[model samples]
Target: MTEIPAFKKNLPTQIAVLGGGSWATAIIKILSENNVKIKWWLRRKSDVDFIKKYNHNPSYLTDAPLNPRKVRAYHKMHDALNGVEYVILAVPAAFIPDALKNLNRNHFAGKKIVSAIKGMIPEENMLVTDWMEKVFGVPQNMLAAIAGPCHAEEVALEKQSYLTIASPNLQVAQDYANLMSCRYIQANPIGDLYGVEYCAVIKNIIAMACGITHGLGYGDNFQAVMVSNAMQEIKRFLDIVYPDPYRDLHSSGYLGDLLVTAYSQFSRNRTFGNMIGRGYSVKSAQIEMNMVAEGYYAVKSIHQVNKQYDVSMPIIDAVYNILYEKAIPANEIMTLRTFLK
Candidate 1:
């Protein structure tokens, strides 16, 4: 663990972190290091009891220390969200509905909601911010999305990581970013919430594709070409969907995120895809990896969303076909090679 930095001059802000995954634990660790008050919600009562008693998450990031004075673990969603100004959504996209089923719009009223989820809603086929806006009635201005190349495993190791907080309201984004920044974490704010979020979702699919190819015994040269083509596909999709003239695909929020997810050893999406490429059935791969790979669900959502825009996303299509349509991984990937330059 890195040295904990001194608290900022202002009073600590009350924030709620939802989910019990590795990412959620990492976020708790970061907030604890910064001396922010955390109300962490986990589904299982046993896990909550363990975290509350031991001052650390028992399942994920067990070695990372948590501040008992500043952090409180809760099994009930209602209790966790109570009196919190900021709420960070770190749960897997597919499980979000079940996790918050007991809560209503009134529970989230006047709160700043930040999505640390990198995937879309599987059932609604909507971005998390969009889903929150429509389902929970969280206004666009109050919703922010976190993007960048940071991984929870590396954060546990105390590696220097950067995060981009995107919201339609820049000032609100900056204020939340302040609570997240610490000795090893640099968080910056941006105004392109939709762009950053859409790109973040798409990058996980691309990472899965990279993993599949690597598992199929494809060399690095081929992966470089595929990733280059993926950038173009992402640009095309973003142009048709969001149409931001000022958005830079080359930034750390976009390109940096895509590259890290595609190649990092810690990427669950890549690991899942690699299993598929190595001849494991989808069910078997999922069983082997107890963790959820966002790309599996994300590729399906992106495929459904792209029906309106009809963007030229060969890589996404290839992944969707393999994962959802039951197309052979080798055949789909081989057919995919013809589409890329």
Candidate 2:
């Protein structure tokens, strides 16, 4: 076993947050409460200008006030990377490649990257960690993931929430966790970097399944069964992919995240699935919501990844069939009922 390094007193104080969505805004909100300097990268110059002038993001989490003195908003990706020791990536999974396209491996050489993204990279079907390693050469010890039952909506309201910072290097995880922890936000450190990241992605797909079932008028009784079964499905998949013997599925990083996303009204993935179950076409639901429902993309990616593992993920199959194959959500879910114990 590798010895965990002691938490260093002098840690990186300058951090950059990439992405302009709710989660990014929420993370900025937490950082604003602290005294550290922050750099924010948003794709739209309009949004960056709006945030700079108004001291708040114009679109997502508009209510969370930002301190202009502490945060410098940048429209260019490289500008945000300059002089920042830590980078927190909160962008949607699909947009990550484009977000970092302008920069090369040299850009991330010594920086610590903390991924707040919960979905896999589209088409590539790789976890953010894997993609980052392949594309940027960021070593495992320098990369970390933030997992949650923590929702950006609740965080904006300053409701108490928990987050698990997972990294192969426990010291890096602990250091990043300290940066994110605030009065309402509690951060815990864990060592299952791959497991936490993979579980985070899998839960989104299961949450979509939950939403689809709910939209089809399945009662609470059935929804409860669906979630319980989802837990087992998650464990089986994780066992094959990461294969950690001591990992606890019931931890806040895994099962807690799954339960909240599956049941919470703020989950965009669930909302997308609900629309599908209610007879809206996938394209229509996507257009109507005007937001990326990551699970829609994730199901296809996981489906491809699972071809090798052959895990018995009935819920995932049901979702993939409905979203990709254009199967009837009601009928597919009806069949899913028989597969779940």
Q: What total of clashing residue pairs does each candidate reach?
A: 0, 0
Which ten residues in a row are the worst by lDDT in model 1? Answer: 2-11
lDDT of 2 by residue, 140-254 (tens): 9999999999989999999999999999999999988888899999999999999999889988998888888888999889989999998998889989888998899998999
Model 1: clashing residue pairs?
Answer: none
Structural similarity to truth (TM-score) of each candidate = 0.96, 0.96
Q: List the residue pairs that clash in candidate 2.
A: none
State the lDDT of candidate 1 residue by residue for 79-98, as single tens digits. 99999999999999999998
Error of 2 at 177 (Å): 0.6
User: Any idea what lDDT model 2 has?
Assistant: 0.91
For each candidate in the order shown, give its overall lDDT on alpha carbons: 0.92, 0.91
